[model samples]
Target: MTTVGNRSITLEDFYQILFKDNAIEISPAAQKRVSDCFAFLLDFAKEKLIYGINTGFGPMAQYRIDEHEQAQLQYNLIRSHCAGQGKPIDTVYVKALMVARLNTFLRGKSGVHPDVVALLTAFINRDIFPVIFEHGSVGASGDLVQLAHLALGLIGEGKMWHEGRQVPASEVLAAHNLTPLSVHLREGLALMNGTSVMTGIGVVNLIHSRNLLNWSLVSSSLLSEIVESYDDHYSAELNEAKHHPGQQQVAAQMRAILQDSDLVRKRHEHLYDKKVTADVLEDKVQEFYSIRCVPQILGPVYDTIASATTVVMHEINSVSDNPIIDKDKGSVYHGGNFHGDYVSLEMDKLKIAITKLSMLAERQLNFLLNNKLNNKLPPFVNLGRLGFNLGMQGAQFVATSTVAENQTFSFPMYVHSIPNNNDNQDIVSMGTNSAQITSKVIENTYQVLAVQLLTTIQAVDYLGFEDRLSSVSREVYQQLRALVPVFTEDGIMTEKILKIKEFIQAEHVQLPASVVGQPAAVAATELVAS
Candidate 1:
């Protein structure tokens, strides 16, 4: 079991709970602080006017609530904003959101009743995910609509996902013998007003995007080997001259992957040692930019992921609630900590980086399919009679179209704010929208790479290059080829393409320890197992 609220939750804790099914328990210290904060707020609000407690919210804040109707006000806030539209977010992401919210509450700055923490912990450990939507939340004022749905579920008033089916939150709660949250002081506002929803989705995007980069690096390494390209492009002597750490690291990782390969040529041994007789050499001096400049191209992507991780991880551990309650100081301070500019900008940048990565994969795939560019294999790497087979020609359309879609979807959401709530929220951050779009871009890139990997293996088979590949490349080739056989004739490849995409996304590629902060591998292994 992973203990929450004892220390800050790391990305590793998230991975274990969300992916590995680890249960969570709230620490006693956090629980006592939550209770103390609630006690303080209950007394503090008895004679004083507090925002969202005694007054109306947003533009309606001037209107005050009567003492008899204060509890109803909280419930009304929750149910009214439960008006989110569009497809429900996936269960895994909703779980992440719940975890983020719970951690914020655990900080004891939200004045939430300890029951809120208990319910959220129960929901996460039992896998009872609230049905959160993708379309709501301008990401200012703290993912209002999306988190309203979360608040609704906790109050046993909305739908939830349980055991792979949509069910009433009340029924699920009863079955588990759990009590619904009763609003005390500002429980509803505390739950609904924060950046946890956007931050949660951004966290999920970070993990998948990092995994995609690892696979892309794997694909690029194998592509270099397939063309018998020169090793100097990824050499330390060449990359070290540039001061960017990401570039040098990428080059070093490539060398580690290609270190034992028999296919990659040494520039000094090939061209420098021998005298050239022909005016125009048969061997092209250097490969295409996509093949040779991988370190430079992907280096920025590495830096972007690193930068986003630092910001998101900090956001995860922060208390993003409005009107931070301080029992220790005997005071409450109100501010816009809920604003999501940090996450919104990072998500926008992350998607743009991923889109570029996909474009690189498409270009590499193009190089392999074009016989004129490569001068090595048949067009489209078709192994059958050239004209009749058509080979991977049809699948290239999917990759091209998908990359185009990603390019269009890469528009930044951070600057696209429109005033709403009668212009009360004149400036807002559409951070949730940014995170959702970034997830789509990441998913699309995986599909593009799926096509690229399938095509690459086809080219490898055509030249019988498996035996001469580096051990890492050989292992990846064998696993992928096992999923889809070499095609000699034109056939429906939709299912095969889907299979490869699923494989790439489901199985974490074991990159060098320096590359991904994990142990380097000589054999294929799942990241969790390693």
Candidate 2:
């Protein structure tokens, strides 16, 4: 069981809550803090006028709502803001959004009742996910529209995904022997006003992006071995001079992945050995940029993902709602923590990094297919009759097109905000859109990397070095080859490419222990085992 509000939550905790069905228990201290905060709000409500407690919302805030009708006002706010449109997001994301929102309330500043927090926890524990739409959030003033739909599910008014089916929340609650919640005071506003959607989606994207980075490292290492490239470029002396942590880390992992390889030649061995001629030695002296600059190109991507992880973890644990209740000071503070600019900008950077990674993979695929650049490999990587078989030629075209599409998706969504909310929100951060596009780019990159790995395995088989690959590279090649056979003659490759993509995204391919973080590596293994 996972305990909320006891300490800061990590990305692994969120993953457990979303995927592992880990039950959540709000810490007793957190319950007391929430109770104390709510009690203070009730006491202060008699003597003062508070925003969202007795006043209207947004542009209507100028109009004063009567104290008796405040409850009605809060209820109406949730129903009216359930104006989200487009397709429903995955249930895992909805559950993640709930977890993010609940963590904010756990800070004891949102002024929500302890029961509200408990109910949210129950939703997660029971796998009751709210049906949240993909659109309708400006990512400022919170993910108002989508979160409002979540708020409706909490009150048993909207649709929910339960037992693998979308059903009315009321029916699901009834079946589970649960009662719908009654909003009191500012509870509805507390629920709907936050950056939960953006943060939740960003967290999920960050997790997948980390996995993708690990796989890209594996793919790049495999490419190095397949091309029989020089390992001097990844020498420790060279990377240490660069003084980049990510660059140094990549160099170490690449060296480990390519350890004990018969194919990858040392500079001195190729230069001094009498068996090799000057022409062959010159060709082995330097590789193309794609193979030569693996660390230089992918190193910054590693650092960017690390930076994005920091920003996302902070956002998940932050109190992003308005009108924060301070029990100690006995006052309410209205601030703009709901703005998602931090997450939006970080996600934008992540997409660009992922796109660059995909471009590198596509270039490597091109190198492997072209006979001249491939170090005397057969044309089109075909092992059969030259003109009769096309091998992975069609698949290479698909990979190139996907990389181009990813480039287009790399355009920053943060720069294209439009004013909304009756012009009250003049500049908005399209954070949800940014996260969504980041996910799409990652999906496309997976296919690109899949094409690269598939082509590498085919090339390895054609070169008759399948049994002589580096230990780690052999494990990765065998794992992929078990799922997808080498293409001797090209037929319909769509299914084979997708199967490889599934293996990549599923993280079934084992990477060098040094490349993947300890926690993530364990998680991936556990996920595959389960």
Candidate 3:
């Protein structure tokens, strides 16, 4: 269990320790540390007139502030920067963002009052997450706008949705018997001058993109087996000849996935004219380039995602807060630690991988939908031509449309930057926008995958008991068969598609017992089986 009150803070703590136990409170030790640091910062400001403490910030740094106006300066900073503009994220994610920001502040290096920590701790304990928009963060200068929106509600200056109604933060805090902080210190800068939102979302996106890549491989293997694709695309010699690490890895995985498929040729027999295979007589045959090049199309996306995950994990564990207080030197030097270029680039790559996978799944669905393309399979993988078996027309439509939407969303937001913050923030990273874009790309992938799942199952039934699917795909087929049986008529496919979506994201695939050693979960299971 992760408790903010009873633990020492560390990078490791944020990555693995703080989850499941969301109850956050300042322990006596943490309170003392925060109090001591806040006192030091105030002393420093009084003596030195630090850049943003006793004076105005950014372009107005030269303007001096009176003692009575210091609190107002910080308040003004929060009020002016609440510029986020988009749909709110999942409550779970909002909670995660809160946790990330709180944990970073608890390091006692951000110069915020202890009472401010207590206020955030209360929000975490009570599950009162502030609504934050996806847009408005430039990913440079610490997600300023989004963090400002988050802080506004904390100061009772903005509205927050609670118990199904938008209400003032003051009322919610009063009702819950929690008090807002009396002294406005560096809490606004502390909250805003960090990469918590990008880091939080990036870490989660890393995990998801990795799993989605695996599922893409799993899905690709299934389609190849269903269409009886050639072994040429995955040959070790072919990939080794060029040896791009990502491409080689993907080809290897494809080979492993189709290892025991009887349909894979022992050798290439003849010309493929889209309608036939081996240029010989066979009802069941090798499919066209769309099906044959499954590995070629999907393998690179998988590799790119894996590489991106590695980069993102390192980034999440990083200390990305500005003005990092040095205990030994007793100085707080402001720097661009929160600049989002690194994160945004990786997220852009994530967008590409996600969009490509959705496109691959859509292509597979197209192959299964066309009888001429699907060899001798029934129209739309229908088990009966006389209206007895329902085709996967609805599911196919969803996959196609979902892919189209994903393509549109993949437009790079990071490339679009503008000067703002009185020109102090001239060039922006838009890292948060990159993260938001990738999130939608991930959702589009789910929709596309759901459709492919429906088509694969339908195609299996179309083949009937006469043809045995590959060992890997057959196991996957059985799992779906248990939930969604062969559609005897044109019934609702939405429910079935939804079910498959849940199963993949939940990692419900099974591992073979015959494997020498492997984890029991489908993550290891599907990889080994494939």
Note each model's CA RMSD in angstroms.
2.9, 3.1, 5.1
> Candidate 3 residues 1-530, lDDT tens each?
35563454432233332333435556676677677777777766666767666778778889988878878888888888887777876655566666667766666677787777778777877777677788778888878877887788777667666986767888887888877655455666777887778766775565456557666666677776666666776788877887466666667766766677766654446344333435556644445666666556766665666556555545544456667655436777778888888878888988987898788778777877887776657777776554655577656777877788889888887787888879888988888888877987887788788788777777767666314666666776787788788776777777888888877765324334332123222232123213
Worst 10 residues of 2 by lDDT: 521-530
- As for lDDT, the candidate ahead, 1 or 2, is 1
Off by over 4 Å in 3: 2-40, 106-108, 115-122, 156-167, 171-177, 182-184, 230-232, 235-242, 251-265, 268-287, 384-390, 465-472, 507-530
- After best superposition, candidate 1 residue 21: deviation in angstroms? 1.6
Looking at candidate 1, the ten consecutive residues that score lowest on lDDT are 520-529
Q: lDDT for every model? A: 0.87, 0.84, 0.69
lDDT of 1: 0.87
Q: Total clashes, candidate 3?
A: 2
Candidate 2 global TM-score? 0.95
Query: For model 1, how does the per-residue alpha-carbon lDDT over 235-321 read when each residue is reduced to its tens digit?
Result: 999999999877877787788888889999998898899887889889889999999999999888877887787788788889899
Ranking by TM-score: 1, 2, 3
**lDDT score at residue 284, model 3, on the 0-100 scale:** 41
